[model samples]
Target: MKILTIQQIIKNIENEVVFEAYAEDESFKIKIDEYIPYVCAAIHDGGQMRDDVLEKCSLSTYERWYEEDPHTAEFVGNFPILIQGCDSRFEYDLNRDPDNAIYEEAWGKNVWETPLSESQKQRSLAKHHAFYEVVEALIQKLESKFKKCVVYDIHSYNWKRWDRPVPVFNIGAELVDHQKFGDYVESWRDGLSLIELGDIHNYTAVNDVFYGRGYLLGFITNKFKDTLVLATEVSKIYCDELTGESFPEVINQIKEGFKTAILNHAFEFIKNETSYKVSKQVNILHNELESDLIKIDKQLYSLVKDFELLSVINPINLEFEKKKFLASNYKYEPQFKYNPLNIDPFEFKRKLSNIKVEKINDISIQNMYVDTINAYFDKVDLLANLGTNKFLYNSLRYFGEPSKKDVDNANFVLYCPEFRMEKEGEFNENEVVELFKNATQDYGFQFDIEVSDHIASKALVINSKKKVVIKKGVKFDKRFTKGLIEHEIGVHMVTTMNALKQPLKIFSIGLPVNTLTQEGLAILSEYYSDSINHDRLRELGLRVLAVNMLTSGKSFNETFLTLMEEYKMAPENAFYLTTRVYRGGGFTKDALYLKGLKTILNYIDQGKKLDNLLIGKTSVEYVDTIDELVDRKMINSPQYFTKIFKKHLEKPEINPILQYIFNGIKD
Candidate 1:
């Protein structure tokens, strides 16, 4: 924030320049981010009292604080246009006219031991006058640019003073033209009531605590008939009224809740009044921060280059050890060796935290970036602890362990009569490579298909390199190849290509819980392509049960025996599933495949589109935000959608047993 004279501030407003500054006299502060049609004002938020006035005042600092609204300015600080007073209302109330701006007695208590001099009164009144001048200029600029405007006049009141219970939010609308703006007021009221403040039951009312008779509201309403001023007030539930101590957590919740509510209300107001949609354009600040974040994100991405958990966790002598374990009558646990971590987790997390998300102007976008970064931090921690006992703990944090419901779901699948079915195919690794190569041609993108002995899975899509690696000597079932194409190329590769086309690199990197959504979508693709069989479903369930055993402190041999004997899985299949869960000291990611499939099934059952999820490697949690960005043209829609989704739309029927299994999974 810079210091500038009131004249300079008004000049910037007139020129429609985006700037944030305090008045040269330090009386008030103003910020113009985009010159939007909405303005937020905290006229009574200031607590600074002049030295001369404090010397003559009979009240203590606590007494003055009791009468002032604290943190009111912060509630709407994320807005594009904001004006807040710096001086206490006791010096001169910005909410009142100049005649009675300075109080003789405040809240029924004496204000001064001696009367204030004429000069002192004039000095304080000058600040009051200057505040209105800037407000007038701001409103004038907005009204001229957009034809009409709305001002959110924010304030707070003491709820303890009333004998009856007061609402959490109060809107003063007595002096406004209700016939024209009553709907907007009611809409604002309804939005505020939806805010969740921890355990606090939130309620909002109009004209219940205070009437909209302040001078600021009257001045703006009388001067600009097209501009509506809402005297928005909050009860003192965020702080103690008598003690003056604040609950920072409660204050933070209010700020976050109000941020979304105010933005939505203003958007609706502007659309109704002017038929203009507020375009979400990235300003220079956003661009600069995004550039900085991408650099750090790319560096973090580099640390895990060959660190695909599946490849890294498998012992180099996996084949030799499996034979030995069988020769030893399955008594010895397979001692798995993992690749050493080449990067420092702490150092990388330090770099990741350097990108200050708070600097981003939009609160919702800021939160998205924050969550994305935190997820990356957890990933780094999980990678650094590979092969160590700590790896399991970190794995649990990143990919949570299965719940009892998941175990029950898996048991239900294991007990099904169709679990023992199997199929054989004639296609080898080379044939599958040719099939994958042919699949990529339709998407008009170049992707590599390599038969490698190093990979653990039959075929894995390495999205970072735009390549698919096939485990050497593995046989692919003819019935599974088509669904494999949909799973790998249609979903994974399509989302990867779509992410690369996005303006922000984070989409390509991914959001938190993307694994759950991505894996689920991939398996759903298999189901949609009609290649999913009872055998494949049984494998998914067995993976979930194996993860449950691993997370429940069961050893590798214990989990392997349970799968082979209790679940009646084949010895070789049980060993493969056990290795996947026990790898990296106890990975829980395999559990998400079944969980993800269930989540996607439920999401589709609700009739939501999968196009947004395919836009990048994002989770279901951020679909709404992605949609918002698309509406504002910040990001483009999916360049390539899952082909299987279109095919499913044509023929939406699935096997009844598969539908029944999906229905059995709980939320």
Candidate 2:
């Protein structure tokens, strides 16, 4: 427990003696003895939040510790190389990517009063990078010294939170090539399962609650071929979780038991036949390619966003650019390098045709990632191109649009005029915000409600800092209250907040091609809550029809008349729906509302899980990609869900007869 710098720790490890050193502010600590071939790490064991960050957090200290794996380092204290984090994961999760190490929400409670500014996030990310720099140096030294090494990446989990009984031990092998290290992983689990202290039945299993798909394990596996790192989580059977107290006997039993188990696995690893070591150059190339794709994604999203800004700056200029750009075949300067996969030319063309899904080694996962990201990039490009052109954008969006036949098969449409809710009474914007606040409060999400004059379209929208913004003159239509709650808070904001907790900035900022899925899922939430109304369904249908008109070269005025004269919508509602379709000189994304609704209904008809829809700012189409990342342990299932769904489902009388019936408004 010596207070020292990373430089000092790296320098002293060669001494072949037990010593410990603390990296900056004592937030992360490491110890080494002689030149051991194995290291132990407790990357998520910390519960300390910086004073600056703590002042802004909504969570109590007890809540943070409950999620943090306590006493992870102590289990392997005797190991020669031991590294563990001391700062609370709420401050920065060492196991996540540095890009999204800081969280906007943790377990659904707003983790910060406001999202940290660039400087504040930079401080935390800088610290994260420093910790990894030391790790890179440490592993490099070990592999150089031992020619091959093993690392026991230690962690813990709360078994009580799980609905079903899980084994006492979980081994994550999602990232590791099992064919190469499967024997060692299995042997470790078998040895630990048999550990006996006072109670003798501590069970162990592999790939239970956690798969060794954490960033630390992934980074080590990718960077160092000779090093086999094991990501392990022990259920909180060794302590009092509510109080973060360890039972002395249980702790000692684990320390002694895992010590034996780890050493045995290490020895076995050294002599294991059929090494699956990949070249260092390949590792470097994969990392570089991944970074480049992310960089391009960031550039594309950041530069192309702000539809409001574009429309406001100079509508005249925008119109001019739109017309001029259309004359040039509606092509604007490319936002990023056009090599969608960011791979070499030949491989890039090949990937477009051959989409493979496998995870045999780093290579297989790398190929899968390439394909996934490329698909996302195309979606993103479509989204970006939407507002820039009416004719061209409509042409592409029309492909995703549901035809009349597909619309006929819509499973749920709020079409019964008999239950018109306008006479039921409406609430003002303040009351609507109050309802939102009450729902979020029940779920432990803390955020502020403010009247905003700056927003363009949202009657209300949740900002990045978790603040709910209401437009100045917005009123809550009685018909829309329940639907808006489930759509925005349950789907949109839930995904936004959950994405902040993930390691990928793409999830927090925006997912590749996620708009359709997000909107579709929001519609699902509205349907599930039984808040769907004829007016809302008609509005959605008109948006699709409006976009169709645009694709067919109809002017904005013509689309507006179709909704008002043909659909008989009121002037105001027609204005909002039509304007949404024509906002950015003929934006076509509104088509997704109708298209996505059909997609989700089809998804439900096929008996697919809906909870995964809440996993970050994700699309239902990218469900497989999300699954791979989860199986790889890159992300977790959404921590917060609309509990209202459970409550709504409990009503036996509310049997929804599956049929979409929309009585067309008379001309």
* Candidate with maximal TM-score: 1
Model 1, residue 211: C-alpha shift (Å): 2.8
Output the TM-score of candidate 2: 0.46
Q: Name the 10 consecutive residues with the lowest summed lDDT in model 1.
A: 281-290
- Which residue runs does candidate 2 get wrong by more than 4 Å? 1-418, 453-465, 648-667
- Per-residue lDDT value at 596 in model 1: 90
lDDT of 1: 0.81
How many backbone clashes can be found in candidate 2? Answer: 4
How high is the lDDT of residue 297 in model 2? 40
- lDDT per residue (tens digit) for residues 27-96 in model 2: 8988664455667899888888778878878888888888898878777755556788989888888988
How do the predictions measure up, each by TM-score? 0.85, 0.46
After TM-score superposition, the amount by which residue 456's alpha carbon in candidate 1 deviates from its true location, in angstroms, is 3.6
Q: Give the Cα-based TM-score of candidate 1 against the true structure.
A: 0.85
Q: Which 10-residue span in candidate 2 carries the lowest summed lDDT? A: 280-289
Per-residue alpha-carbon lDDT of model 1 for 1-667, expressed as tens digits? 6999989999999998878899998889887767678888998888998899889998888999998999898888767678988899888999899998999987899898999999999999989888888888888888888888989999999999999988899999998888988889898899899988999989899999898899999999999988999998998899999899998678767887887688778877887795345544222112223333455446545543333445456566666667777788889778766666656778877877766665554555666777877887887887788778998998899889998888888878766667314675558888888888888998877899888755546678887777888878777787677778888999989999999888776677788879999999999988777787777778888999889888879998999898888877888767777877887788899999888988888888788988889988889888877876766567789999887788778778776777677778847
